[model samples]
Target: MAAGPNEPKSRYLQYLEVVTGSLEEKRRYRQYKARVKRLPENYRTAVEALERYLMHFGPADGAGAMSMYEDLADLFEQSVADGTPIRDIFGADPVEFVEAFMANYPAGQYRARERNRFTSAIQRAAGEDTGQDGTDR
Candidate 1:
Protein backbone atom coordinates (compact mmCIF):
# COMPACT_ATOMS: atom_id res chain seq x y z
CA MET A 1 0.00 0.00 0.00
CA ALA A 2 1.13 3.51 -0.69
CA ALA A 3 1.83 5.97 2.07
CA GLY A 4 -0.57 8.83 2.60
CA PRO A 5 0.37 12.11 0.90
CA ASN A 6 1.60 13.49 4.19
CA GLU A 7 3.88 10.53 4.71
CA PRO A 8 7.28 10.38 3.08
CA LYS A 9 8.02 7.62 0.58
CA SER A 10 10.47 6.72 -2.11
CA ARG A 11 9.82 8.06 -5.58
CA TYR A 12 9.25 4.51 -6.79
CA LEU A 13 6.55 3.99 -4.17
CA GLN A 14 4.91 7.28 -5.12
CA TYR A 15 4.93 6.14 -8.75
CA LEU A 16 3.25 2.90 -7.77
CA GLU A 17 0.56 4.76 -5.85
CA VAL A 18 -0.13 6.90 -8.90
CA VAL A 19 -0.41 3.84 -11.13
CA THR A 20 -2.58 1.84 -8.73
CA GLY A 21 -4.93 4.59 -7.62
CA SER A 22 -5.78 5.73 -4.09
CA LEU A 23 -8.94 6.16 -2.04
CA GLU A 24 -7.90 9.64 -0.97
CA GLU A 25 -7.52 10.70 -4.59
CA LYS A 26 -11.00 9.40 -5.37
CA ARG A 27 -12.45 11.30 -2.43
CA ARG A 28 -10.71 14.50 -3.47
CA TYR A 29 -12.13 14.07 -6.99
CA ARG A 30 -15.66 13.82 -5.63
CA GLN A 31 -15.15 16.99 -3.64
CA TYR A 32 -13.72 18.74 -6.68
CA LYS A 33 -16.77 17.82 -8.79
CA ALA A 34 -19.10 19.04 -6.09
CA ARG A 35 -17.25 22.33 -5.97
CA VAL A 36 -17.47 22.70 -9.72
CA LYS A 37 -21.19 22.04 -9.58
CA ARG A 38 -21.62 24.96 -7.20
CA LEU A 39 -20.20 27.41 -9.72
CA PRO A 40 -22.40 29.67 -11.85
CA GLU A 41 -23.75 28.05 -15.03
CA ASN A 42 -21.39 29.89 -17.33
CA TYR A 43 -18.39 29.16 -15.12
CA ARG A 44 -19.44 25.55 -14.76
CA THR A 45 -19.71 25.15 -18.52
CA ALA A 46 -16.33 26.75 -19.07
CA VAL A 47 -14.75 24.64 -16.34
CA GLU A 48 -16.24 21.49 -17.82
CA ALA A 49 -14.78 22.33 -21.22
CA LEU A 50 -11.33 22.95 -19.73
CA GLU A 51 -11.70 19.75 -17.74
CA ARG A 52 -12.46 17.75 -20.88
CA TYR A 53 -9.28 19.03 -22.46
CA LEU A 54 -7.30 18.33 -19.27
CA MET A 55 -8.41 14.71 -19.20
CA HIS A 56 -6.60 14.19 -22.48
CA PHE A 57 -3.64 16.57 -22.14
CA GLY A 58 -2.95 17.18 -18.46
CA PRO A 59 -0.96 15.36 -15.81
CA ALA A 60 -0.22 11.65 -16.10
CA ASP A 61 0.43 11.05 -12.42
CA GLY A 62 -2.69 10.46 -10.35
CA ALA A 63 -1.64 12.74 -7.51
CA GLY A 64 -0.50 15.43 -9.90
CA ALA A 65 -3.73 15.14 -11.86
CA MET A 66 -5.79 15.40 -8.70
CA SER A 67 -3.80 18.35 -7.43
CA MET A 68 -4.24 20.07 -10.79
CA TYR A 69 -7.98 19.44 -10.71
CA GLU A 70 -8.26 20.67 -7.13
CA ASP A 71 -6.35 23.83 -7.93
CA LEU A 72 -8.38 24.36 -11.08
CA ALA A 73 -11.56 24.14 -9.07
CA ASP A 74 -10.21 26.57 -6.53
CA LEU A 75 -9.20 29.01 -9.25
CA PHE A 76 -12.59 28.91 -10.94
CA GLU A 77 -14.45 29.13 -7.67
CA GLN A 78 -12.45 32.17 -6.74
CA SER A 79 -13.02 33.62 -10.17
CA VAL A 80 -16.76 33.19 -9.90
CA ALA A 81 -16.68 34.91 -6.53
CA ASP A 82 -14.66 37.75 -8.06
CA GLY A 83 -16.89 38.07 -11.15
CA THR A 84 -13.90 37.54 -13.42
CA PRO A 85 -14.69 36.68 -17.00
CA ILE A 86 -13.70 33.22 -18.25
CA ARG A 87 -11.72 34.71 -21.14
CA ASP A 88 -9.79 36.84 -18.68
CA ILE A 89 -8.96 33.78 -16.62
CA PHE A 90 -7.56 31.68 -19.45
CA GLY A 91 -6.63 34.50 -21.81
CA ALA A 92 -6.74 34.30 -25.64
CA ASP A 93 -5.29 30.78 -25.99
CA PRO A 94 -6.69 27.98 -23.88
CA VAL A 95 -3.95 25.60 -24.95
CA GLU A 96 -1.31 28.07 -23.96
CA PHE A 97 -3.09 28.68 -20.69
CA VAL A 98 -3.23 24.99 -19.87
CA GLU A 99 0.38 24.45 -20.85
CA ALA A 100 1.45 27.29 -18.64
CA PHE A 101 -0.70 26.04 -15.78
CA MET A 102 0.66 22.53 -16.07
CA ALA A 103 4.17 23.86 -15.89
CA ASN A 104 3.78 24.22 -12.12
CA TYR A 105 3.22 20.45 -11.91
CA PRO A 106 6.33 18.99 -13.48
CA ALA A 107 5.36 15.39 -12.76
CA GLY A 108 2.55 15.62 -15.33
CA GLN A 109 3.65 15.23 -18.98
CA TYR A 110 6.98 14.67 -20.73
CA ARG A 111 8.55 13.73 -17.38
CA ALA A 112 12.27 13.87 -16.90
CA ARG A 113 13.08 10.25 -17.76
CA GLU A 114 10.75 10.29 -20.73
CA ARG A 115 12.17 13.61 -21.86
CA ASN A 116 15.71 12.14 -21.68
CA ARG A 117 14.66 9.11 -23.69
CA PHE A 118 13.04 11.29 -26.35
CA THR A 119 16.09 13.51 -26.60
CA SER A 120 18.48 10.58 -26.73
CA ALA A 121 16.44 8.83 -29.41
CA ILE A 122 16.45 11.95 -31.56
CA GLN A 123 20.22 12.34 -31.08
CA ARG A 124 20.81 8.73 -32.09
CA ALA A 125 18.64 9.11 -35.16
CA ALA A 126 20.71 12.14 -36.13
CA GLY A 127 23.96 10.15 -35.66
CA GLU A 128 25.02 12.30 -32.75
CA ASP A 129 26.26 11.20 -29.36
CA THR A 130 24.43 12.90 -26.49
CA GLY A 131 26.20 13.32 -23.17
CA GLN A 132 24.52 11.84 -20.10
CA ASP A 133 23.38 15.36 -19.36
CA GLY A 134 21.59 15.36 -22.76
CA THR A 135 23.88 17.83 -24.48
CA ASP A 136 25.21 16.91 -27.94
CA ARG A 137 28.78 15.65 -27.68
Candidate 2:
Protein backbone atom coordinates (compact mmCIF):
# COMPACT_ATOMS: atom_id res chain seq x y z
CA MET A 1 0.00 0.00 0.00
CA ALA A 2 1.40 3.35 -1.04
CA ALA A 3 1.12 6.20 1.44
CA GLY A 4 -0.71 9.21 0.09
CA PRO A 5 0.99 12.57 -0.30
CA ASN A 6 -1.09 13.95 2.58
CA GLU A 7 -0.02 11.16 4.89
CA PRO A 8 2.13 12.15 7.85
CA LYS A 9 5.82 11.64 7.35
CA SER A 10 7.77 9.06 9.34
CA ARG A 11 10.10 10.22 12.12
CA TYR A 12 13.14 9.45 10.01
CA LEU A 13 11.78 11.48 7.13
CA GLN A 14 11.04 14.38 9.46
CA TYR A 15 14.53 14.19 10.89
CA LEU A 16 16.00 14.28 7.39
CA GLU A 17 13.89 17.29 6.50
CA VAL A 18 15.10 19.12 9.57
CA VAL A 19 18.72 18.28 8.77
CA THR A 20 18.37 19.52 5.20
CA GLY A 21 16.71 22.72 6.33
CA SER A 22 19.43 23.37 8.89
CA LEU A 23 22.11 22.92 6.23
CA GLU A 24 20.39 25.44 4.02
CA GLU A 25 20.15 27.85 6.90
CA LYS A 26 23.85 27.44 7.63
CA ARG A 27 24.65 28.26 4.00
CA ARG A 28 22.60 31.42 4.23
CA TYR A 29 24.33 32.36 7.48
CA ARG A 30 27.71 31.93 5.87
CA GLN A 31 26.63 34.40 3.23
CA TYR A 32 25.49 36.68 6.01
CA LYS A 33 29.00 36.48 7.49
CA ALA A 34 30.52 37.89 4.33
CA ARG A 35 28.15 40.81 4.61
CA VAL A 36 28.96 41.22 8.29
CA LYS A 37 32.61 41.81 7.53
CA ARG A 38 31.66 45.01 5.73
CA LEU A 39 29.89 46.38 8.77
CA PRO A 40 31.60 48.84 11.14
CA GLU A 41 34.11 47.33 13.52
CA ASN A 42 31.96 47.47 16.65
CA TYR A 43 28.87 46.12 14.90
CA ARG A 44 30.90 43.38 13.23
CA THR A 45 32.43 42.34 16.52
CA ALA A 46 29.09 42.30 18.33
CA VAL A 47 27.41 40.29 15.61
CA GLU A 48 30.22 37.77 15.49
CA ALA A 49 30.20 37.36 19.25
CA LEU A 50 26.47 36.84 19.19
CA GLU A 51 26.88 34.18 16.53
CA ARG A 52 29.42 32.37 18.66
CA TYR A 53 27.09 32.49 21.66
CA LEU A 54 24.30 30.97 19.59
CA MET A 55 26.62 28.24 18.35
CA HIS A 56 27.59 27.33 21.87
CA PHE A 57 24.27 27.57 23.74
CA GLY A 58 21.43 27.54 21.23
CA PRO A 59 18.96 24.69 20.87
CA ALA A 60 20.29 21.14 20.59
CA ASP A 61 17.97 20.31 17.68
CA GLY A 62 19.19 21.34 14.25
CA ALA A 63 15.91 22.94 13.26
CA GLY A 64 15.64 24.90 16.46
CA ALA A 65 19.25 26.00 16.24
CA MET A 66 18.69 27.20 12.69
CA SER A 67 15.67 29.15 13.80
CA MET A 68 17.74 30.82 16.50
CA TYR A 69 20.41 31.71 13.99
CA GLU A 70 17.84 33.15 11.64
CA ASP A 71 16.36 35.23 14.41
CA LEU A 72 19.74 36.60 15.45
CA ALA A 73 20.62 37.29 11.85
CA ASP A 74 17.34 39.11 11.38
CA LEU A 75 18.10 41.25 14.42
CA PHE A 76 21.44 42.28 13.01
CA GLU A 77 19.91 42.93 9.61
CA GLN A 78 17.26 45.07 11.15
CA SER A 79 19.82 47.00 13.11
CA VAL A 80 21.68 47.73 9.92
CA ALA A 81 18.46 48.79 8.24
CA ASP A 82 17.63 51.06 11.15
CA GLY A 83 21.09 52.65 11.16
CA THR A 84 21.50 51.72 14.79
CA PRO A 85 25.01 51.90 16.12
CA ILE A 86 26.19 48.55 17.47
CA ARG A 87 27.48 50.14 20.62
CA ASP A 88 24.14 51.85 21.13
CA ILE A 89 22.36 48.58 20.45
CA PHE A 90 24.51 46.26 22.52
CA GLY A 91 26.10 48.75 24.93
CA ALA A 92 29.81 48.75 25.71
CA ASP A 93 29.82 44.99 26.28
CA PRO A 94 28.79 42.77 23.39
CA VAL A 95 29.75 39.64 25.28
CA GLU A 96 27.45 40.60 28.12
CA PHE A 97 24.61 41.12 25.70
CA VAL A 98 25.20 37.71 24.18
CA GLU A 99 25.26 36.12 27.61
CA ALA A 100 22.00 37.83 28.48
CA PHE A 101 20.44 36.59 25.25
CA MET A 102 21.57 33.06 26.03
CA ALA A 103 20.13 33.24 29.54
CA ASN A 104 16.62 33.54 28.10
CA TYR A 105 16.72 30.06 26.45
CA PRO A 106 17.82 28.01 29.45
CA ALA A 107 20.00 25.76 27.33
CA GLY A 108 23.62 24.62 27.90
CA GLN A 109 25.16 22.41 30.60
CA TYR A 110 23.25 23.86 33.53
CA ARG A 111 19.82 23.71 31.94
CA ALA A 112 18.72 20.62 33.79
CA ARG A 113 19.68 22.03 37.16
CA GLU A 114 18.07 25.35 36.31
CA ARG A 115 14.89 23.57 35.21
CA ASN A 116 14.75 21.61 38.43
CA ARG A 117 15.20 24.75 40.48
CA PHE A 118 12.48 26.55 38.54
CA THR A 119 10.11 23.63 39.04
CA SER A 120 10.85 23.52 42.74
CA ALA A 121 10.29 27.27 43.06
CA ILE A 122 6.95 26.99 41.30
CA GLN A 123 5.91 24.09 43.50
CA ARG A 124 6.90 25.99 46.61
CA ALA A 125 4.94 29.04 45.50
CA ALA A 126 1.87 26.88 44.97
CA GLY A 127 2.26 25.37 48.44
CA GLU A 128 2.32 21.95 46.81
CA ASP A 129 5.18 20.68 48.88
CA THR A 130 3.94 20.51 52.44
CA GLY A 131 7.04 18.75 53.66
CA GLN A 132 10.43 17.42 52.50
CA ASP A 133 8.72 14.37 50.92
CA GLY A 134 6.95 16.81 48.52
CA THR A 135 3.63 14.95 48.60
CA ASP A 136 0.55 16.99 47.77
CA ARG A 137 -1.66 14.82 49.90
Candidate 3:
Protein backbone atom coordinates (compact mmCIF):
# COMPACT_ATOMS: atom_id res chain seq x y z
CA MET A 1 0.00 0.00 0.00
CA ALA A 2 1.19 3.53 -0.72
CA ALA A 3 1.90 5.73 2.26
CA GLY A 4 -0.33 8.74 2.84
CA PRO A 5 1.04 12.29 2.93
CA ASN A 6 0.90 12.28 6.75
CA GLU A 7 2.72 8.94 6.99
CA PRO A 8 6.44 8.79 7.38
CA LYS A 9 8.39 8.05 4.22
CA SER A 10 9.94 4.58 4.03
CA ARG A 11 13.53 5.80 3.87
CA TYR A 12 13.05 8.09 6.89
CA LEU A 13 11.03 5.47 8.73
CA GLN A 14 13.83 2.95 8.31
CA TYR A 15 16.00 5.02 10.63
CA LEU A 16 13.22 5.61 13.20
CA GLU A 17 13.88 2.26 14.87
CA VAL A 18 17.67 2.41 14.77
CA VAL A 19 18.95 1.94 18.32
CA THR A 20 22.45 2.79 19.33
CA GLY A 21 24.77 -0.23 19.19
CA SER A 22 22.07 -2.23 17.40
CA LEU A 23 22.90 -4.40 14.38
CA GLU A 24 21.01 -2.05 12.09
CA GLU A 25 22.99 0.94 13.31
CA LYS A 26 26.22 -0.96 12.94
CA ARG A 27 25.30 -1.98 9.42
CA ARG A 28 24.56 1.61 8.48
CA TYR A 29 27.85 2.75 9.98
CA ARG A 30 29.77 0.14 8.04
CA GLN A 31 28.06 1.12 4.82
CA TYR A 32 28.89 4.77 5.37
CA LYS A 33 32.52 4.00 6.16
CA ALA A 34 32.86 1.83 3.05
CA ARG A 35 31.45 4.60 0.88
CA VAL A 36 33.75 7.20 2.40
CA LYS A 37 36.77 5.00 1.77
CA ARG A 38 36.34 5.48 -2.00
CA LEU A 39 37.03 9.23 -1.83
CA PRO A 40 40.52 10.76 -2.10
CA GLU A 41 42.30 10.70 1.27
CA ASN A 42 42.32 14.45 1.73
CA TYR A 43 38.70 14.80 0.70
CA ARG A 44 37.83 11.81 2.86
CA THR A 45 39.39 13.43 5.91
CA ALA A 46 37.66 16.74 5.32
CA VAL A 47 34.32 15.05 4.80
CA GLU A 48 34.73 12.97 7.95
CA ALA A 49 35.70 15.98 9.99
CA LEU A 50 32.72 17.97 8.67
CA GLU A 51 30.44 15.05 9.48
CA ARG A 52 31.71 15.04 13.04
CA TYR A 53 31.14 18.76 13.40
CA LEU A 54 27.63 18.53 11.99
CA MET A 55 26.81 15.59 14.22
CA HIS A 56 27.60 17.80 17.16
CA PHE A 57 25.91 21.00 15.97
CA GLY A 58 23.56 20.25 13.06
CA PRO A 59 20.04 21.66 12.80
CA ALA A 60 17.07 19.88 14.38
CA ASP A 61 14.50 20.69 11.67
CA GLY A 62 14.13 18.82 8.37
CA ALA A 63 14.29 21.96 6.24
CA GLY A 64 17.40 23.26 7.99
CA ALA A 65 19.06 19.86 7.73
CA MET A 66 18.34 19.61 4.02
CA SER A 67 19.62 23.13 3.41
CA MET A 68 22.82 22.48 5.35
CA TYR A 69 23.55 19.25 3.47
CA GLU A 70 22.87 20.85 0.08
CA ASP A 71 25.11 23.82 0.87
CA LEU A 72 28.00 21.65 1.99
CA ALA A 73 27.65 19.37 -1.02
CA ASP A 74 27.67 22.37 -3.33
CA LEU A 75 30.81 23.72 -1.65
CA PHE A 76 32.61 20.41 -2.09
CA GLU A 77 31.52 20.04 -5.70
CA GLN A 78 32.61 23.57 -6.54
CA SER A 79 35.98 23.04 -4.90
CA VAL A 80 36.54 19.83 -6.88
CA ALA A 81 35.51 21.52 -10.13
CA ASP A 82 37.98 24.32 -9.48
CA GLY A 83 40.81 21.75 -9.26
CA THR A 84 41.54 22.69 -5.66
CA PRO A 85 43.31 20.02 -3.60
CA ILE A 86 41.29 19.00 -0.55
CA ARG A 87 44.17 19.42 1.87
CA ASP A 88 44.88 22.83 0.45
CA ILE A 89 41.20 23.67 0.75
CA PHE A 90 40.87 22.60 4.38
CA GLY A 91 44.51 23.46 5.20
CA ALA A 92 44.90 20.77 7.90
CA ASP A 93 42.46 22.80 10.02
CA PRO A 94 38.96 21.47 10.42
CA VAL A 95 38.06 24.32 12.79
CA GLU A 96 38.97 26.89 10.16
CA PHE A 97 36.82 25.13 7.59
CA VAL A 98 33.93 24.99 10.02
CA GLU A 99 34.31 28.65 10.88
CA ALA A 100 34.30 29.59 7.23
CA PHE A 101 31.23 27.49 6.57
CA MET A 102 29.36 28.94 9.53
CA ALA A 103 30.19 32.43 8.33
CA ASN A 104 28.19 31.83 5.18
CA TYR A 105 24.90 31.69 7.11
CA PRO A 106 23.33 34.97 8.10
CA ALA A 107 22.53 35.59 11.74
CA GLY A 108 19.19 34.26 13.06
CA GLN A 109 18.71 31.61 10.39
CA TYR A 110 18.76 28.97 13.14
CA ARG A 111 16.78 28.94 16.36
CA ALA A 112 18.04 31.63 18.68
CA ARG A 113 18.88 29.21 21.50
CA GLU A 114 20.72 26.79 19.24
CA ARG A 115 22.55 29.61 17.52
CA ASN A 116 23.66 31.08 20.83
CA ARG A 117 24.78 27.68 22.09
CA PHE A 118 26.74 26.97 18.92
CA THR A 119 28.32 30.39 18.96
CA SER A 120 29.32 30.01 22.60
CA ALA A 121 30.81 26.58 21.93
CA ILE A 122 32.84 27.91 19.03
CA GLN A 123 34.00 30.90 21.05
CA ARG A 124 35.13 28.67 23.91
CA ALA A 125 36.98 26.41 21.54
CA ALA A 126 38.78 29.38 20.01
CA GLY A 127 39.81 30.61 23.48
CA GLU A 128 37.97 33.84 22.88
CA ASP A 129 35.61 33.40 25.82
CA THR A 130 37.55 32.99 29.05
CA GLY A 131 34.72 33.08 31.56
CA GLN A 132 31.39 31.32 31.96
CA ASP A 133 29.67 34.68 31.93
CA GLY A 134 30.88 35.26 28.36
CA THR A 135 33.34 37.91 29.39
CA ASP A 136 37.06 37.79 28.84
CA ARG A 137 38.91 37.33 32.14
Candidate 4:
Protein backbone atom coordinates (compact mmCIF):
# COMPACT_ATOMS: atom_id res chain seq x y z
CA MET A 1 0.00 0.00 0.00
CA ALA A 2 3.05 2.24 0.24
CA ALA A 3 3.35 4.72 -2.60
CA GLY A 4 6.65 5.41 -4.30
CA PRO A 5 8.17 8.85 -3.72
CA ASN A 6 7.37 10.15 -7.19
CA GLU A 7 4.09 8.31 -7.75
CA PRO A 8 0.71 9.93 -7.37
CA LYS A 9 -1.62 8.37 -4.81
CA SER A 10 -4.22 6.24 -6.48
CA ARG A 11 -7.97 6.29 -5.85
CA TYR A 12 -7.57 2.88 -4.20
CA LEU A 13 -5.04 4.35 -1.81
CA GLN A 14 -7.47 7.17 -1.09
CA TYR A 15 -10.09 4.56 -0.31
CA LEU A 16 -7.65 2.74 1.99
CA GLU A 17 -7.21 6.01 3.84
CA VAL A 18 -10.97 6.24 4.16
CA VAL A 19 -10.98 2.81 5.82
CA THR A 20 -8.54 4.21 8.39
CA GLY A 21 -11.37 6.55 9.49
CA SER A 22 -9.61 9.82 8.76
CA LEU A 23 -11.56 13.11 9.03
CA GLU A 24 -11.80 13.28 5.26
CA GLU A 25 -13.15 9.73 5.21
CA LYS A 26 -15.80 10.72 7.74
CA ARG A 27 -16.87 13.62 5.56
CA ARG A 28 -17.05 11.38 2.50
CA TYR A 29 -19.08 8.79 4.38
CA ARG A 30 -21.52 11.45 5.52
CA GLN A 31 -21.84 12.63 1.93
CA TYR A 32 -22.51 9.06 0.86
CA LYS A 33 -25.24 8.76 3.49
CA ALA A 34 -26.82 11.98 2.27
CA ARG A 35 -26.83 10.67 -1.27
CA VAL A 36 -28.53 7.47 -0.14
CA LYS A 37 -31.09 9.49 1.82
CA ARG A 38 -32.01 11.49 -1.30
CA LEU A 39 -32.94 8.37 -3.21
CA PRO A 40 -36.59 7.33 -3.63
CA GLU A 41 -37.95 5.28 -0.69
CA ASN A 42 -37.85 1.85 -2.29
CA TYR A 43 -34.39 2.34 -3.72
CA ARG A 44 -33.26 3.77 -0.40
CA THR A 45 -34.52 0.70 1.46
CA ALA A 46 -32.93 -1.65 -1.03
CA VAL A 47 -29.59 0.15 -0.76
CA GLU A 48 -29.79 0.05 3.04
CA ALA A 49 -30.43 -3.70 3.02
CA LEU A 50 -27.61 -4.31 0.58
CA GLU A 51 -25.31 -2.07 2.64
CA ARG A 52 -26.06 -4.04 5.77
CA TYR A 53 -25.42 -7.34 4.07
CA LEU A 54 -22.25 -6.10 2.38
CA MET A 55 -20.89 -4.66 5.62
CA HIS A 56 -21.18 -8.09 7.20
CA PHE A 57 -20.05 -10.34 4.35
CA GLY A 58 -18.36 -8.25 1.69
CA PRO A 59 -14.73 -7.14 1.20
CA ALA A 60 -12.52 -7.34 4.30
CA ASP A 61 -10.11 -4.72 2.97
CA GLY A 62 -11.04 -1.12 3.65
CA ALA A 63 -10.29 0.10 0.15
CA GLY A 64 -12.29 -2.69 -1.41
CA ALA A 65 -15.21 -2.14 0.94
CA MET A 66 -15.35 1.58 0.26
CA SER A 67 -15.10 0.96 -3.48
CA MET A 68 -17.96 -1.49 -3.25
CA TYR A 69 -20.06 1.01 -1.32
CA GLU A 70 -19.35 3.73 -3.84
CA ASP A 71 -20.28 1.40 -6.68
CA LEU A 72 -23.47 0.39 -4.89
CA ALA A 73 -24.50 4.02 -4.65
CA ASP A 74 -23.74 4.56 -8.30
CA LEU A 75 -25.71 1.47 -9.27
CA PHE A 76 -28.90 2.45 -7.43
CA GLU A 77 -28.72 6.02 -8.63
CA GLN A 78 -28.53 4.80 -12.21
CA SER A 79 -31.30 2.31 -11.56
CA VAL A 80 -33.49 5.07 -10.22
CA ALA A 81 -32.93 6.94 -13.46
CA ASP A 82 -33.68 3.84 -15.52
CA GLY A 83 -36.83 3.01 -13.51
CA THR A 84 -35.57 -0.45 -12.72
CA PRO A 85 -37.55 -2.62 -10.31
CA ILE A 86 -35.95 -4.30 -7.29
CA ARG A 87 -36.77 -7.72 -8.67
CA ASP A 88 -35.24 -6.77 -11.96
CA ILE A 89 -32.10 -5.58 -10.19
CA PHE A 90 -31.52 -8.66 -8.00
CA GLY A 91 -33.75 -11.29 -9.59
CA ALA A 92 -35.21 -14.22 -7.62
CA ASP A 93 -32.28 -14.70 -5.21
CA PRO A 94 -30.94 -11.81 -3.18
CA VAL A 95 -27.99 -13.79 -1.79
CA GLU A 96 -27.01 -14.85 -5.27
CA PHE A 97 -27.23 -11.28 -6.43
CA VAL A 98 -25.03 -10.05 -3.59
CA GLU A 99 -22.47 -12.79 -4.22
CA ALA A 100 -22.32 -11.82 -7.87
CA PHE A 101 -21.89 -8.18 -6.93
CA MET A 102 -19.13 -9.07 -4.48
CA ALA A 103 -17.17 -10.88 -7.18
CA ASN A 104 -16.22 -7.52 -8.68
CA TYR A 105 -14.46 -6.55 -5.43
CA PRO A 106 -11.93 -9.28 -4.70
CA ALA A 107 -9.41 -7.35 -2.62
CA GLY A 108 -11.46 -7.72 0.56
CA GLN A 109 -12.03 -11.43 0.33
CA TYR A 110 -9.58 -12.98 2.80
CA ARG A 111 -11.06 -16.31 1.85
CA ALA A 112 -9.11 -16.31 -1.40
CA ARG A 113 -5.86 -16.38 0.51
CA GLU A 114 -7.17 -19.05 2.80
CA ARG A 115 -8.21 -21.17 -0.15
CA ASN A 116 -4.76 -20.91 -1.66
CA ARG A 117 -3.14 -21.67 1.65
CA PHE A 118 -5.34 -24.68 2.14
CA THR A 119 -4.48 -25.98 -1.28
CA SER A 120 -0.76 -25.58 -0.66
CA ALA A 121 -0.98 -27.22 2.74
CA ILE A 122 -2.81 -30.24 1.34
CA GLN A 123 -0.27 -30.57 -1.42
CA ARG A 124 2.55 -30.51 1.10
CA ALA A 125 0.85 -33.07 3.28
CA ALA A 126 0.42 -35.33 0.27
CA GLY A 127 4.15 -35.04 -0.48
CA GLU A 128 3.56 -33.25 -3.77
CA ASP A 129 6.07 -30.76 -5.20
CA THR A 130 4.06 -28.04 -6.86
CA GLY A 131 5.50 -25.91 -9.63
CA GLN A 132 5.43 -22.09 -9.66
CA ASP A 133 2.13 -22.26 -11.45
CA GLY A 134 0.78 -24.58 -8.72
CA THR A 135 0.77 -27.67 -10.91
CA ASP A 136 2.36 -30.86 -9.60
CA ARG A 137 5.97 -31.11 -10.77
Tens digit of lDDT per residue, candidate 2, span 1-137? 32356887777766875766543456666767777776667767777777777776665554455556656667777898899877787788867777776555536335555666778778888978635564322
* Candidate 3 Cα outliers beyond 4 Å, as residue runs: 1-38, 105-111, 114-137
State the lDDT of candidate 3 residue by residue for 9-43, as single tens digits: 47545555353223334454555566556666776
Show the colliding residue pairs in model 4.
60-108
| Alpha-carbon shift of residue 137 in model 3 (angstroms) | 27
- What is the descending TM-score order? 1, 4, 2, 3
User: TM-score of each candidate?
Assistant: 0.75, 0.50, 0.47, 0.69
Kindly report which residue stretches of model 1 are placed more than 4 angstroms away from their true locations once superposed.
Answer: 1-20, 109-112, 133-137
- In candidate 3, the residue pairs with backbone N, CA or C atoms under 3 Å apart (3 or more residues apart, or in different chains) clash, namely none
**Candidate 4 lDDT tens digits, 25-133:** 4666777888899999999999999999988888876567777888899999999999999899999999999999998997455766776778887888798975546
Error of 2 at 105 (Å): 2.9
Residue 115, model 3: Cα distance from true site in angstroms: 5.9
- How many pairs of residues in model 4 come into backbone collision? 1
Candidates ranked, most accurate by lDDT first: 1, 4, 2, 3
Residue 63 local lDDT, model 3: 44
